[model samples]
Target: MSATPPPYHQTAVRPDWRDLPDGLREAVGGRLGASVVAARTATAGFTGGFAAVLTTATGARVFVKAADLARQRHLADWYARELAVLARLPADLPVPRPHWALDAAGWYAVGLDAVDGRTPRLPWDPAELDAVLAGYAGVAAALADPPAGLTALGLPRLADLARSDILWWEEVAAGREPVPPLIPPARDRLPELVALESRLPGYAAAAPGLAHGDLRVDNVLLDPAGRAWFCDWNWLCHGPAWFDLAGLLITGYADGAGLDAVFAAHPAAVDAPPDALDVTLAALAGYYLTAAGPPATADPASGAGTVGPGAGPAGGNPAGTSALLGAHRRFSGEQALRWLAARQGWH
Candidate 1:
């Protein structure tokens, strides 16, 4: 079987067993009532911190993750949000079950049911895609309305991204940010592009139910039973149910899966808002175009690396820069934008 690149790339640094703060580990132990026998480190996630499945004294397994808020405050905070989101998800949802969480002295960690599975590799497995779509269908069914505490928890709305997340293309077009030569053709049509994207918030705001705001390959795991479980609930939101499906379509497009072919078989994509695929693709294009082809202020990870510093509201790049990271974002963004344009008939 040929392997395509992973749907998302995680090249950020992660700490090993020796690197976690003493309090965080102790807190995990205290909550589980098990002595930490070994830390099986994980390297797939992008947050670039500590993530592992802990083996307890009694041979019990619990998934545990911790991040340094002081160094990467936003990512750490997002990890904290996962604890909150996990606590309230329905029992049947295909996600890790949350056991406990800890936030002491700025270091945060959470323990979850260790899932026995693997993130699916690319070239799109039919069985795996079918399983994941079924999982998404379940999520859509369960979250047709937001759960009781989810709204009160104050999760972000997709409309909130209009100014912040979707306007990137416009910003770079106007020369506010430096432009990179490797960009989408849509940038040249800024007014039209901006107007097209501006319409998304209304569509997004009118979304029927809660959405997994970030749904990509890296954030998913396929179990031995061929079931799919979505990870990383930090970007959870109240939005259109089909949003994740749209992202998947775009991902398919990027991976040479034949966008129409992916959509024809995906029931959720078939049932989503008529214009959602185009709009969501546009939104993705706008978001990625900003980082991929800009004056390098920060690195944006399309599926490989991330802006870490220059990509979001979190702040600027503190770690200086990495050419490899930038190249990944730029390339991923370029492809995503192009795909969006084709979907929109902008070409």
Candidate 2:
């Protein structure tokens, strides 16, 4: 049998913008103008960084994101890289227009033209889901072969990243902290995952493509016209095309029959080669389990005793957290269990 999963603290922590460097304000004002009409917090449940909506005197609106420099430098680099990627994409693609990026002092900021839209409620209609998926697929098709000289968003390849992610889960499972029910199964599934990894390279070699590594419902923006635009390219990288489709299927769509319909709709399009599906499923499992498990005090960005069980003033929304955990349980629990059972040589 697999070892007991590690104990974890699941909490939401909001970063204080008051401590943000003055240079960030100066940079924002300099680029957009000194007339800062209004500033307000935008979203509620992100764990990586803080976000705000800034309105200038001229009525121009921009979304500013302040990421933790001490905790994740790669994320900062991704902000810069995303700007370049947006620049490379055809102007017509349904993506936010990145205005400018600021990397001053120890903080990093990215300003993008705020799209007028909102996140649709979960259990979306069939047409809505199809539209979102189609939009994403179109974007991928457009950038089928990335332009030359474009730097990757500093994200590791899928195979390598998957392996590292598994090890991280393993470490968390073996840690002193309490492991949530969702994680033990993920830990147990490592061997088959390892076996799948060995066979992925060959399939990946067939069609090397670009993917928006994180394509959950939250990252997608639906405008008043029902158009969908993707944001948050921090985890962007080159990998199997199916990786992106799998991410959406596993996280955004429902499980069981709903999931079967999604695959049925896009026969060859969503059918990943051999173990590619497993790798993607395994990665998704690890992401939610780790994201839901707990906060690490040592992690200044997400792990500081700011959010999770027994969180302080800046902790996350309990209702939202409960909803997220519930969704993860619905779609990912079986995969997590299968992963765990595989470790024990269970058929």
The top-ranked prediction according to TM-score is: 1
For candidate 1, give the lDDT of residue 2: 12
TM-score of each prediction: 0.84, 0.71
Clashing pairs in 1: 9-303, 178-295, 180-293, 299-307, 301-305, 301-306, 309-317
Tens digits of per-residue lDDT, candidate 2, 29-60, equal: 88777666777665434344656778888888
Runs of candidate 1 with Cα error greater than 4 angstroms are 1-10, 104-106, 183-187, 252-256, 264-267, 270-272, 293-306, 313-315, 318-328, 344-347
For lDDT, the strongest prediction is 1
Please list the Cα RMSD from the true structure of every candidate, rounded to 1 decimal place: 4.3, 7.4
Clashes of 1: 7
TM-score result, candidate 2: 0.71
Error of 2 at 108 (Å): 2.7
Q: Tens digit of lDDT per residue, candidate 1, span 184-296?
A: 45646666665666677888787768888877666788889888888988888877766677665444333555765666556555556666666676666667545544434
Steric overlap count per candidate: 7, 19
